[model samples]
Target: MNTLIKQFTLFVVLTLFTGMAAVAQQSDYQIQQDFRTEYNELLERIDQATTTEALEEIEEAINDLEDEYEQHADLIDASSNPDSFDGAISTLRQTHASAVESISTIEDLNDQIEDLETEMEGVKSRLDQLSDERTTLQQQIDASTENEARQASLIRQYRENIEERNLFVSNFLGELLSKYQSMDSAQQQEISEAAGRLEENPIDVIKNVINEYINMMDQSSALMAPDYVSMKAQHGYFVEVWDSIGEQLVNTFAPENPAQTQEEVDQLLTAWQSSITNNLWGSIRTSFSENGVELAEFNSSEEFFNALNSYLDGSIETSVERNSEEDYDVYREFNNFWSNTVKAEWGEMFIEGDILSQSQISAIDMKLDDWRDEAMPTSNLTFILLIVSIAVIIGLIVLLLTRKSGESKA
Candidate 1:
């Protein structure tokens, strides 16, 4: 009975020891897995770090991971699994490499930021120099009262300097605004202040530009005064200015301009409509009335176009015979103004159903086509004359040669 009891006690004791041993081995395996998991997470964070502070945080985590890894190193080394030991060591090396790469990235970003700061400083310096030069030039321009040419030269220089400075401001504002969101609070505030100092409101710029165009057009009209040839050239110049101003208006509201807004764009469009109606259309109508094509005489668009074509084709033909180069130029200017400007207005009116119907528009288009076809014959008139002149010269030469041959035979 005593022998059986001793055997049973030994069996129970051995079983408990075996269970404890298994639990300890499982616990070690869990600890190693946790370390690897933590190390992997640190590596991931290192790769994603954008700032010095973030990198520093990742560095601390890496260090902690290393300490934990060291604590388990002996256990991992003693474990029967060679793969577990190798994996831990390999992960440690990978974490170090990740940290080094993160540091390099941070350094590179810092260098880029420094370079940008330097470039911006240079721009500000140039801007200041230009402003000083402009001030000095303006004083010179103001002092030179009697010498018109010298004053003009000084004014031109002043204007050029101002334009350069303004261009710098525009470009700087654009660049700063684009990078603003990526900036820290302090950097954003600094850039915002700088941009505020330099930025011109796009709406104001557009208004000033349009006003300048209007003034230029008015001046050109005055220069046209009584000279028909100069009127044509000036009209052509005015058209170019008008088109260029329209394009400038579009660019002013472009996405790149920081001050562009929907309300401002609407105001600009309204201003354009008013300017076209009062300034451009009014001026053109006045000019036509002065030229003897009474616009009021034609109630219908058909009558209006017919009278215009007749004046251009028939009435102008006799005048062209006595016309000089200047007259031809004036005539060409009138032609273009009629085709480009007047026709544009007419088309708009047609679309609005204000003056012409769809049928009327089509009729006028056909009439204009027929007129062009008729004008084709007139276009070839010069060529026809050249051919006739050549034929006459050849006949005269042949007659002279025949007479000389007959005389020689005699």
Candidate 2:
């Protein structure tokens, strides 16, 4: 009976042990199955992710999976039946990291593009406001025709506003140029396409600004009484602005045809220069004619200076030979011409526009000063000659009177 009891006890113990082993084995199999299922789901999610946020969430889930199955790594590897859990996890981590990095780069590029667009919009808004103010000031100038002072004031204000607007545009272009040069090819292309989509592309804005300046120049050239001083300032400002962006404009279009783009830019600059020359010379000719100084049409600055020098030399020689009071009036007239017309009206224009060198201006000034010295003598030689003649006449009268007295005494 004791032997029978021992056998029953052995059977019961063996049965409980087998059942427990089966349960533990089943639990490990479930764990492996759960890990695989989650891992596959994560792979799909990583493949489909298009944003950093989505990829980050998937990465976190992957980390959790790794942590949860860390203790059962060997069992999970065995359950894989030819694939190790660790190898798969490594691949998943690599893929997840790559996805996250790619998505993050894309997001960063998109953010940069957005910032550029916002800045462009702000520039457009400011330009629109300036345009409105300029229009109002122009209207005020036109309506104040009866009040010359008011008209002049309004015109000055209008010009100041234009200068401000142009300066802002130049600075904006400079900043954009720096930004464009700093960008990678991909970012550059993206920005170029985006700018092209706007109502006015940045290239078109540059072109339009140049065209507007040219138009203003043409208007000034056409005027019977052109404001040469103001026109000179405006032209100088336009040149400065163009110099800042002209290279960028050419580079922007260089991908298509570099030579043609360069030719077009050169043509625009030449037109600007020609307009300035025509306007200044036309006004000078009119002023010379009004002042009784005959000035012929000149094709070049050298020709103009030669003709002026010759005329001044001839006038000086004539004044020296005549030595009359009329020459003094001529001196005053020529001095006024030099001071008000040559120096005041056109000197700055010629120098700033690079039409004439400083040495050329200095040479002209020296010639004018020499002519002034010759035309108006400081010694008063005419007065001295008159006094000597009077003394001779008085001496002759005294001798005649003394001879008459001797005859009366005889």
Candidate 3:
């Protein structure tokens, strides 16, 4: 029994010793595996680092791993074979040596890289300057190649424009001279004054002269138109001017404002209306004398009407024997003569010539329409005045007759 008990105790001690050895060996292998993995990872970090700063960061991690490896040195040495610990220690020593060697060369390598970059920048700047100079030289060559053709084209255009202007001036000046001879004193003075302002530009001077002359002829023609015969006679006076000028004045220059042009001509006609009145009234008096009805000399429109009324009354009383006041209505006859002969002659002129275009005819019609519209209000006021005058005159006659009858009776 004693011997069996001894054998049991010995077996138990051997089993415990073998287990402790196996545990220590396993711990050492684990540490070796961990160290190998960490060392490999740090080496990979160092190889991947591009900058000196990044390489220094890996160097810090390596120093930390090395401190931890030394702290576990006794356990590794006691628990495992010397070969296992030696392999890890040698790997750490070689890695430290390589890191120190790499750190020593870093500053010089960075300086060399910076110098190369500076040299490349200078080369790039010089190449850019040379490229700019080449571009400038090419541009100068192209401009020199095109200069002769561009100059020739400009000269050709200049000559053509000068020739066209000369031809226009020549034709216009000829027509202007011929028309100047036929213009009245007022028209000549107006054109000469306008032309004097444009001495620097002969073309414009002649254009203004032609424009003024045409405006006068148009006004004269319009004012004389209600009497077609008189209008035709007036137009005939300027027929040569019309033939020479043709539609050149209107066709060459666009009227700035057609309505304004008509207004100006109307104003001019008003200023020159004395000549028209003399022409018309002189013709009337001459015809009346030819008809053997002697008229009293009259200057005013009112006196002229009174002389006409006296002629009509005397002529009617001698020729037609009438008993009633209505039969001897001399005023009505005067009104008829004024409305049918004089007013009708003064109203609208019928345009019937090739010299005036449709546009000009329409403009004339518009002017006449405007004048008639403006005159309508005045004509109504004039009629009202005539009525009031007649009523006052009748009342005065009645009052005089009543006073005369009362005095006779007394």
Q: Candidates' lDDT values, in order?
A: 0.53, 0.71, 0.49
Clashing pairs in 1: none
Give each model a TM-score: 0.35, 0.69, 0.25
Q: Residue by residue across 235-299, what tens digits does model 3's lDDT show?
A: 33334443444333322222344355434434443433444444545555654455444788865
- For model 1 the local lDDT of residue 43 reads 66
TM-score of 1: 0.35
RMSD of each: 13.4, 11.3, 34.2
Ranking by TM-score: 2, 1, 3
Which regions of candidate 2 fall more than 4 Å away from where they truly are?
A: 1-18, 50-59, 79-93, 181-187, 193-199, 218-280, 284-294, 299-349, 378-410
Please rank every candidate by lDDT, starting with the best: 2, 1, 3
lDDT of 1 by residue, 1-410 (tens): 99999999999999999999999989998877776678568667766766667776766776666666777887767765544645755665676566667566656655655565566557656755775675577578668889999987876675456446545654654554444324455443333333333334333443444443333334322222122222223333333433334333233223355344544544544554444334433444466776543444453435655655565555346444544444444455555555665456345533342334566556545544444434434445578889999999999999999999999999
Clashes of each: 0, 0, 0
Single out the weakest 10-residue window by summed lDDT for candidate 1: 221-230
TM-score of 3: 0.25
Give the number of colliding residue pairs in candidate 2.
0
Candidate 3 regions exceeding 4 Å error are 1-10, 29-54, 75-97, 100-123, 130-410
Instruction: Mark the regions of model 1 whose C-alpha exceeds 4 Å error after superposition.
Output: 1-76, 79-87, 162-410
Model 2 lowest lDDT segment of ten: 220-229
How far residue 312's Cα lies from its native spot in candidate 3, in Å, is 99
